[model samples]
Target: MDIFEFYKKMDADDIMLSFKGSVTSELLTSVLQIIEAKMERLNEPSKIKKKVYNVLVESLQNLYHHMDKNEQDIKGHSTVIFMIGNNAKAYSIYTGNYVRNENAEKLQAKLEKINSLNPDELKAYYKEVLNNGMMSDKGGGGLGMIDIARKSGQKLNFRFQQVDNEFSFYSLNINIAKQ
Candidate 1:
C-alpha cells in the first residue's frame, strides 16, 4: 500500500478516526472517550455531540454484538472496519463486517425498509418492533438500524458485497447533520 497516497485520501475524505480490528468492550470505551475529547476540543455544540455519540454507540454496539466470528475465508474472520468522518454537511460513521451468507438478504431487506420510512413511520415502526419482541439471528431484528435512522434523521446507507460462498461483507454508512 502507498502510505502517502492513503494519507492523502483520508485527508481528502475528512476522516477523523478509522480502525480495522476486532471489536471489544475496552476498545469501544476508548473510542467513545476519544470522540468525546475530540468533540470538546473542536467545541462542537451539545446537541450535535449528543446525537453523534448516541448513533456511534448504536453503530459500534451492533458491530460488536453481531460479528460472525466463525465466518469462513479470512483468518481473522472477526475483524471489522470502522471510520468517522467530518465534513461541512455532516459527521459520518461507517462500519463493515462479515455476515453469514444466509443472513445477508434478510439484513438488506430490513435496512431498505428502515430507509423507506419517514420520521413518524420510523417512530411507529420502532415501537411496533419493540412490542413484537422478535430477536434476529444476531439479535434485535433490525432494531439497531431503526434506532440509527431515527437518531440520525437520515436514511441508512448500506451494501453487501459477496466475499465467498459462505460469507458476505456488510457495510453501513450513517451521517448526522452538523446543523
Candidate 2:
C-alpha cells in the first residue's frame, strides 16, 4: 500500500476523519470526541459544529444498532466504513455497512419516501411517526432518518450495492452547511 497516495487522496477529498471497523458504543464515543476536537481546533462556527455533531450521532447510532447481523455473509467479516469531510461550503458525513439483501428493498423504499417530502412535510411526517409510537426492536421509532433530514435541511443521499446473494452494502451521505 502507498501511504503517501492514501494521504494525498484524503487531502484531495477533504476527508477530515475516516474509519473502517466493527461498530460499537465505545468506538462511537471515541469518534465523537475526535471529531469534536478537530472541529474545535479548526474554530468551526457553533451552528455548523452542532449540526455536524448531531447528524454524526444519529448516523453512528444507526450503524451500531442496526448494521447487518454480526455473522456477516461476506467471509464472516463485519465492519462499517465512516468518514467526515470538510470543504468550503459544507461538512459531509458518509457511512457504509453491510446489510442483509432481504432488507435492502425496504430500506431503499423508506429512504426514497423520506427524500420525496418537502421541509414542512418532513416535519409533519416526523411528528406523525413520533406520535404513532411504533418502534423497532432496536428502539428506533423510525425517527432518526427524518430527524437527520429535518435537522440538516437536505435530502439524504443513499445507495445500495449488492455484495452477494445474501448481503448488500448500504451507504449514506449527509451534509451540513457551514453557514
lDDT of each: 0.89, 0.88
lDDT of 2: 0.88
Candidate 2 RMSD to the real structure: 1.8
Candidate 2, residues 100-140, lDDT tens digits: the string is 78888999999999999999999899989998968877746
What would the TM-scores of all predictions be?
A: 0.91, 0.92
State which candidate has the highest lDDT.
1
Q: Once superposed on the true structure, which residue ranges of model 2 sit more than 4 Å away at CA?
A: 68-77
What lDDT does candidate 2 reach at residue 139? 47
lDDT tens digits, residues 1-179, model 1?
89999999999999999999888889999999999999999899999999999999999998888654343445656899999999988999999998878889988888888888899999999999888968767657668888889999998889899989988999999999999
Model 1 ranges off by over 4 Å: 68-75, 135-141
> Alpha-carbon error at 53 in model 1, in Å?
0.3
